[model samples]
Target: MAVRTPVKFYYDILSPYAWFGFEALCRYKKPWDLDLQLKPMNLGIIMKESGNTPPGMNPSKGSMLARDVQRVSEMMDLPYNPLEHFAKTVFIRGSLTTLKTLAACQIMYPDRLEEMTRQSWLGLYSRDIDITDKGNIIQFATAANIPDVDQLLAFSLGNEARQQLITNTNEAVESKCFGAPWFTVTNPKTGRREKFFGSDRIEMLGWVLGKEYVGHHPPQ
Candidate 1:
């Protein structure tokens, strides 16, 4: 059997850029011959730990990121309408729930991870629903086949889940993560690791993989 190349993604739903990057990955993955692993981490926590401000937060950037999000969303063909005064805590809800979904993937349904990743992103960005809202969170979880919605919400709110999120954030920080849409790719055959950041770098990823860049023509 051939071993598939593994790509590790670390992101937060709070980031429209990350959403854009993930959309690129979804588009180019097959041609790249990759096995994508979605690893959810809160960029908010990473920023706090690293003492870095998000680009959207900088008045100097002058709404570049906000506007870029809309441009990239249209280019990628994924629906996106960022919420106003976006609640930061909602990322925590997603992080914890994503962890639970990943766990569920390990035991029985390995495909659950992909399902949850797509559903959660669309729920937050496409559907434009507030994930911090309990009902919406449950709706996302249910769509992902996550068992026990109330329990998942409780865990996400409780100390343990928060700590897990913190730990994941710290780990990403230790990895020198500056923002969302950070990726760590491991060559399964030779145990090599490469890091790539940003949606624009998706073509570079294809270059590294010795594949044609098809990011401009997204899959229908």
Candidate 2:
């Protein structure tokens, strides 16, 4: 029997690239014999501690990133209808509520984190919904049909969720993570842990795992 590779996927839903990366990793998980770990972290804290400035912070980079996000979505064939005045509203307002919900899910519904993440991504990217709002967060959670949702909702709004987000963010920073969609893949045989950054690194991750690099868009 082949040994399964352990992959720790650290993501922040605020990033379109992280959404794409999460999908790509999920698509390849079984084929690559992976033990995928979904880790939700606070990108704001990661950026602050890692001394990394968001591309959106710069006017030119922000414009380029917006276009790049569209192109990547097209390449991956993912839905990405961003909210109006996304730069001013979504970016400025941040995704604390959504992140807290994901963190709470991590604690309460570990098995459902991926589904919740997918729904959260769709809420922000596909539906153009502001997940930062408490109402929207609850709405999305209930829509996802998560188990113990009321308790989950309360947990997300409490101190437990805040601390979990902080702890996850701190772990990412400790791993030298400067951005979201960061991955730490541990080779079971060699006992080596490798860190990878960005959605573009999916191909390289396949190479590292000794799996076929079938490009970004795999057949549906």
Candidate 3:
């Protein structure tokens, strides 16, 4: 039997591009024989530490970003409401609490991490719901049917989850990450690690992993 390639996906729920990248990877997981590890990190810290200014800070760049997001969403067949939802919701609720919760799920509910992350992104980007709200966090946890919702919530709100998020963010900064949806893929054939950035780079990933370059919307 062939060994599955290890792919670490570093993401933050605050990034719509991360959502696109995450969905793309999830779609290719089985076809590419990938062992996908979801690494939840703080994108704000990455931008800050890397000295990279977010494009959304500039009005023209922000407008271009909205158009790009719409185009990408259409191309990927992924659901995204609008940049308005992003500016209104994410800026208000912030990224830390939501990411810490995801970090907690990564630790205690590894199996459910993917679904939980999807639900979180959908809540924020699709439905314009704040995933960082205390009640909404519990709601998402309950909906995912993660065992012991109370404990998970507590852990998310506690120091351990905070530390985990900090660690993940620090690692991402050390890796020279300037944005979300950062990928660190271990080539199965050569035992070498390769880094990929952005949702459009999956073909490069396929090349490194010795896999076919399936379309973004490969038939299920």
Candidate 4:
């Protein structure tokens, strides 16, 4: 019997790069022999714990980062919208709703977790909807054919899932992941480990699955 390796994907809804990677992950299935785990976290808390400031607060690097992310989004054929509102405001309201909804989806329909995540990301980044709006959240959930939108919403606002989300965030931090779109690949057979960050390195995901990479290098 072969042990299947799990690929843990750490993401935050506010991250455009995570959206891109989430989309990419949706396209690959069992041929890769990978178990995908979606771990949502409050990126702000993670940054604070790691002794880093939010990108939008760093004047010198923020603009450069915006351009770099936009370029990558274009390459991936995904939309990149730099929120006009304050980063903290967006993170507090929008990301929390999205993450909690994701947790609910994970609990209710584990098989459809990837699809739900992709749709949620599209609603936020591509459709430019107010993800925090209850109506919009339910709309996204229903569009994905996720049964019981009201039940999921109840779960999202409930104490249990929220606590689980916090625990997941802490686990990511303990694993030394400091940012969004973190990928952890461990071969269960031999226990080989590989970690990559950002959607730019997603091609490496296929490579790690034993897919031939003729000539590919990590994006700088």
- Rank order (by TM-score, best first): 3, 2, 4, 1
> TM per model?
0.79, 0.92, 0.94, 0.85
RMSD of each candidate relative to the true structure: 3.6, 1.9, 1.6, 3.9
Instruction: For residue 25, give model 2's deviation from the true position in Å.
Output: 0.3
Q: Score each candidate by Cα lDDT.
A: 0.68, 0.85, 0.86, 0.73
Q: Which model scores highest in TM-score?
A: 3
The residue pairs found clashing in candidate 4 are none
lDDT of 2 by residue, 1-220 (tens): 8777778899998888999999999888777877788989988888888889888788889879878999999988899875687766556878887888899998998888888899899988998877777778777777777877789988998999899988888878999999978999875557688899998888888877778977765644
Model 1, runs deviating above 4 Å: 87-110, 147-164, 187-192, 218-220
- Ranking of all predicted structures according to lDDT, beginning with the best and ending with the worst: 3, 2, 4, 1
Q: How big is the RMSD of model 3?
A: 1.6
Local accuracy of candidate 4 as per-residue lDDT tens digits, 10-68: 88888887887766665453445457788878787878888866676688877797788
| Best candidate (score: lDDT) | 3
User: 166, model 3: CA deviation in Å?
Assistant: 1.3
